[model samples]
Target: MKTSVILNQENLGSVLSNVKAPTYDRDKVTTSIVHIGVGNFHRSHEAYYTNELMEHFGVLDCGICGIGLLDYDRKIYNILKDQDGLYTLMIKELDGTYTAKVIGSIVEFIFAPENPFAVIEKIAHPDIKIVSLTITEGGYNLNEATGKFDFSNPVIIEDMKNPMSPKSVFGYLTQALKLRMERGVGGITIQSCDNIQGNGDVAKKALTNYVKEAAPELLSWIEENVSFPNAMVDRITPVTVAADKEILKEEFLIEDQWPVVCEPFIQWVIEDDFKAGRPAWEKVGAQFVENVVPFENMKLRLLNAGHSLLGMLGALHGYNTIDEAANDPDFEQFLKDFMDVEVTPTLGDLGDINLDKYKKSLIDRFQNIYIKDLISRICLESSAKIPIFLLPTLKQQLRNDGEITRAAFVVAAWCKYNDGVDENGNTYEIKDAMSDTLIRAAALSHKDPIAFLKIEAVFGELVNNKRFVETFTNTLNMLRINSVKLCVQKINSSSTSV
Candidate 1:
């Protein structure tokens, strides 16, 4: 198929006229890898890296066959198809710098639920060596209480029974594996790019447990053959907006169906284990490390956790965007103090690096106005996010017989925000992240903060800890009476604030 340049030299005459866009033959592209979630994050981070690999190393053998699991994702599918699976990615730097590059790595797009058989056949194809996923935390059938697989979830059970439905990522993958095994096809690497701790292990557990319960023979074959490589992917890609689209079209003179804009900084670290071999990603900027735990911890706990801190607190203060929250003096000081007092000590040595420099860079990243990271978007799914992002630090502080007052303040502020009351004491709709449970808990315990924390699914074993229970209960009570800002001020000014 002959491809035409969407934005030619005449269209974008001067602003970006000197940029020499790389070209690729659509017919030469082959589906060597299939990605489950084709969201903006995946397109900006992994797909872009794969595009660079092909451009620099001349390895166009691998092209992503995009898969959309949810019904809502059909819109994304349609948009990409309109563009012939071609899109431009704009990388925004903290110092007001930007670069635009057109990505042509996705060869074909498929909706798994709409056409299960076709997705399965594509996965079963011998050339598709790797199947990577970024289906978000909620997509996994995890029990809310223990942070483990919810074997009892109805959707999972249905998928387990009717594997051809390919209702879930695990179901689609396992079903494809079953077909591959029957046809004597080699195993593919299961790579997870989610934010969960030990993400690859979690993916492995979900798939293996499901297969063991549903088909023991398949489980045995998977254990013997497949490799689930743990990875850490870092790039902040907020959902696109009209203004962003206008900027792209007016400034760059390109009509992108779904343009992805993200921070220029990107990081990908893998566990160096692949069953059917992998791309030469390191030739670009992707990092391959023996141990990904340290890097994962540094990103998850520090960057992601800081994002949560700004999110809940930002909402409580009536700030719409993360950059807005960073502009407020109280929120700014609260975040820095929380980082210095709470998060810094818990993090181990990060590859002989300066901790102060990392913290400075993180702060600067949060203050970017180009990408309006919505507070509400970040605030959703606190149940899954808080445990991985914030709780470990609190637990570590407890182990050392130290206080997590500021950290406790974050939890209290979040609970108050989840109470279905806005900063003005007006009711607002809360979406996702245990909305019903949190709302009911908040309304029922309007006078008692402890009642809200008793929900086992959200708090889990952490609520039962004597020290944490006392600290959290007291902090919540104080915040309920004095409000977040006042309570935080009191804590920061206290003699034993840290």
Candidate 2:
């Protein structure tokens, strides 16, 4: 296996010995979707599904044309372009078996920052029916208090004035749609794959509010023609680090520049509300339903909320990976109780889901020894995760008069973790968008546990509520004084008894 054998269209036949190459003919495929912010999750999940559909159902028109918006996306574009948009998807199973396949669903890569006009032209093309996004939750420029587009965002301010030179995803979307309208192209569906509740609606409101002043008539046409379908996407794809490349080479003899490694499970539940049309994605294991709210509720409360519970705790206790944290008896039991008691009561009826079984399955997935998902990565963008993943359940729990001690504990541990010092005096650098303010608030929290909650941008009015304040104060004190391990054991002791 020589390194000279590059992974591209010319070498596809040669690499079939090690990598399960796509069976569909690449030349026949046509781009139907333009995916912005083509990151690891989009590759492992959506591209994987499109490949599956093309191979089995001969659906080649929905092939993805991946677009990179930010300057950092240049690295992805160059690497993927060199490989002809082909990459290996490695899946690790619990039984020590793994699968490797070279996915070729992404037929093209467009770097928007370098050439925004060409990218917009492609999106505005009549053939491209859907413009999807995997931009992170914060990428939407949402105001935390109102859950709407933040018009005050500097990028939004710039884009509104000069839509032609768009900087943000919203800019690209608006400019492309404007071109479509001018060119007499019919409507297109804008799908949001970010982990926000009612994601389609969120993107819809953001786009609707954004274009109102700039193009009022276009706004009217968009309101009538465009459709944003709410969707829930799930997968535990870890970041592809340097070591993963060596592993791929050793195990599969494939020298992929950026291969994605994930657990053996993946799911996408989407609302069937596309205005123009959509891929028969259900043919490839994607569920097209009338409403995705129940699935969203189940995932947000059970899986995402579970991560918020353990990510900071794992870092505080010096665990490196999610499995290490979940494998611990104390942390494992705490998650069970947290889900069964605190989180489950906040969820609506999730039809056909045995929640107890689902909870156990989450434990299994989190404990997948082969995935090696980094807790530090999970802790990335903590300020954003707090509101999107945890606070919804907290607000609901307060309204329903449900148990919130565990939820409060999660927030408290996050605050303690932000202090940059663990119980053993070992130090860490605080990593967050509001690190300076959070660290200052965390320092004051030692004396005043309510200090962190006073930041209205993050905690809102929850600080004034006596119930939340008292609970959070007690948990913060416990995390600061005792070892995180002991505090977790104490919390589990009560949970396990119940």
Candidate 3:
């Protein structure tokens, strides 16, 4: 097969020119990993890392075959197809180190909406070793309150009724795995790159449940053969805007269909449990750990938690991006105190990365002006994010009966944001799907204060935990009186007062 796009080696050099190579041509690449949801994050982080694997380490068996589980992903598939599966990843560094590297890790791109059977066939291909995902937290079709598969969801029902027309990613993955087992293809690693607790395990459970309900044989087979490796992936990647496109055009001198812009900081820690042969990803700077729980806790509690706090606070304070939030002295101090006092105590010591270093990196990443990670992007799905990022610390504080003033501040801020208005009294569109439900819930809670605590979907059964409920009620009352800003000030004053 002929290559689609040509890059001039003379002008851009051999190192720079091979970014747009076609994957279907067997001569140019070897397919080892299949990645679902080839969005900006996967393109910038995973694909860039793989490109480095080929360039620096000389390990050439890894190439990504991109698969999309949604109709919206078709545009990205076409963009990558036109460029022969190459796109530039612009990594914005805080220390004045800017890089624009074209990555060619993905050789073939297919959209499940238009080509569902093709995706299933590709998954059952003998040579494909790793099946990875970057589908967001909500993509797994999990219940926000229960942290498990919501079998009652309409999509789940559709998938159960029509397995061949599998709508959700979870259903499609199960169907594909069934094909692999039936066709006698060996086991493959199911690696999840989403930012959820036990992400890989969650993926395993969801896929397993779907198989068990729809096809018991596949579930049994997966339990015996498939290996789901838990991982922690971190990088601040924002949705690409028109101005971002203009920046890419000026910097790289090429028009990319879906260019990714991200902060320089990126980390991937995986549990070494692949059943099949895998890529030497460590050669490309991936970390393999015996247990990833400590690392996961640190990232989830401090970094992820702080990001959520800052995002809501920033939006309330009339800021667009994280850098703007970092610039506010009050917001910056609030974040520092929240991490230092409340979040740090909850984190039971990470191996090499202690609380100090982790806290510093959180502030530094937030302060990186070049990345422009929008506060609005992080503000979505507070109902989902609060449990993973904020609830753990809250639960821990309650157990210890420790001073949780700052933690209360975050809860109050979320409640305030849930009111669906900014500090300026200007109403912005609430971007969450549960906006109407949450708004009514919060308003009703304001009527009786403790009444809102009854909504277990958002608060979970933890609302009955007396210590947590007491601190939370006090903090919410303070917020309503002095506003979120003053509530944060009081908490920081009491928690970290020197």
Candidate 4:
């Protein structure tokens, strides 16, 4: 048996010979970015990239000061704090091999709830050039129907009332920007690494709208001083499980409290616009594009939508993880058809990206046996995901009279999955922000077939579309009688793309 060493700065030298540890001097690194919502994805993607830049390109100025803004963030905050902001990043390769790297980019972590002022002060610091966020799609606090900042949120209301003692992300950002303006600090970029399309633009609107109401004086300063640049980020990072920890301790001889595991593939396509300055991340593999829309569209439509398709259908079929469902021949075929028939036409110009190769790679990635991406993780906050990832392709298909069968089936699968019981009669918790509403509508679908679709917040005008309604209704009815697996096979074998 190998000797196990706790993963921290002190034990970095004692780690297994194969494990890659940060070679840079930790004390010499300084924070140029204050990142909010330091979750698995943030650690696995943005922090990983920054660590590479520092390690390979000698970019020490771009070190990150991680901020945890949520109550759930306390867990990670404690872990990273204990380990001195050091954690293992286990990359599960497609060939079923593992590569371990100790990431040291997150030089410090601040739990916002402990001292909100400390968090604000860090963002306001002159050395901080970028305030980055990985606060998921729903965290933006947007009115889903209006596609704008929601002032009606109780948290937003409370933050607006007591600006100094703020709770929400925007409130903290606004207060920090106010301080920055007062201190004559130069402009900074607010970079959003969320999966939302035009994420930076959304961040700009949400922050500016909040500033417009809460601190009208800061609006002009923000307009001139702040920049929000859109980015397209891609990686398959699953939540860390106990087995991952065991593997680290037993196989790698590293004891990590919270280590992140992900697929080897990673991509970051950022808009080439930054106000203050940015790390030479392009030296490390990040693509800096003039426009990220074309790339963003390809990812959101193909990769993201494909994940949702597998997740919803996989859950209903009683599969516990994405790989389990993706490895199924029937499910694999359905995903390919969905990508080729329904989603492809929606993507107009992808510049030079080969759609066929991209789609094939997506299938291969999903079926990676080493990356045990939980179905529940993919299904989590799906109400927010479906609208942003899958709905646009669906709307485009409806307008062009293209293939709607696969997309409609995925919606039906979502309705069925929300019932909180799979075909095997095993109950699982429906994890979503709109869980109650979704379950209620899904339960009502048994009697009123269109009840789920009538959820105006989710389906919107799609409920009014007769062809979509008929197809969705039929699929939902078929699902009620047949197994999810059977329905998938039928959809795959179907002659028409109706």
> Considering only N, C-alpha and C atoms within 3 Å, which residue pairs clash in candidate 4?
none
Point out the higher-scoring one by lDDT: 3 or 4.
Answer: 4
TM-score of 4: 0.98
Residues 1-498, model 2: lDDT tens digits: 355346788788877465688878999999999999899999888889889898889998898999998999999999999999999888887885668889999999999889989898999998898989998877777767666677888888898888899888878887888888888899999999988888898898888777886677789779877889989999999888888888777777778899898888899999898877888889989999999998888887789878877788888988878999999988998888888887888787788889889888899999988788998888877887788888888888888878888888899999988888666667877667678888899889888778899877788888887888888888888887788888888887774211
- Each candidate structure's TM-score, on Cα atoms with residue i matched to residue i, is 0.94, 0.96, 0.92, 0.98
Candidate 3: give the clashing pairs. none
Q: Which prediction has the highest lDDT against the true structure?
A: 4
User: In model 2, what are the clashing residue pairs, if there are any?
Assistant: none
What's model 1's lDDT at 56? 76
Q: How do the residues 1-498 of candidate 3 rate in per-residue lDDT, one tens digit apiece?
A: 222323222223333342343222324678889999898889877887887777676666888899988788879878877767777777777875457776767778888888889888888888888899988777777776776677888888998899898888877777888888888887988889888889888888878877778888777788877898999888888888887667655544556667788888889999999988888889878899988988888888888888898888887777889888887788899888777767777777676675687678789888888778888888887777877888888878778876576666677677777787777787766677567777777788687766666666667787788766777788778777675566666665664321
- Number of the candidate with higher TM-score, 3 or 4: 4
lDDT of 1 by residue, 163-183 (tens): 777587777787789888999
What is the per-residue lDDT of model 4 for residues 1-498, given as tens digits with 9 covering 90 to 100?
568999889988999889999999988999999999998999999999999999997888899999988889899999998899999999998788789999999999998889999999999999999999998899998866567787889999999899999999999999999999999998999999999999999999999888889999999999899999999999999989999999888888999999999998899999988999999899989999999998999999999999999999889888999999999999999998888888889889887898899888999999998898999999989989999999899889989988899898999999999999988889999888889999999999999989999887677888889999999998999999999888887888885853
Q: CA lDDT of each candidate?
A: 0.79, 0.85, 0.77, 0.91
Descending-lDDT candidate ranking: 4, 2, 1, 3
Error of 2 at 99 (Å): 0.5
- Candidate 2 displacement at residue 36 in angstroms: 0.7
Of 1 and 2, which scores higher on TM-score?
2
Q: Who is ahead in lDDT, 1 or 4?
A: 4
Tell me the number of clashing residue pairs for each predicted model: 0, 0, 0, 0
Residue 195 accuracy (lDDT) in model 2: 85
Error of 4 at 97 (Å): 2.1
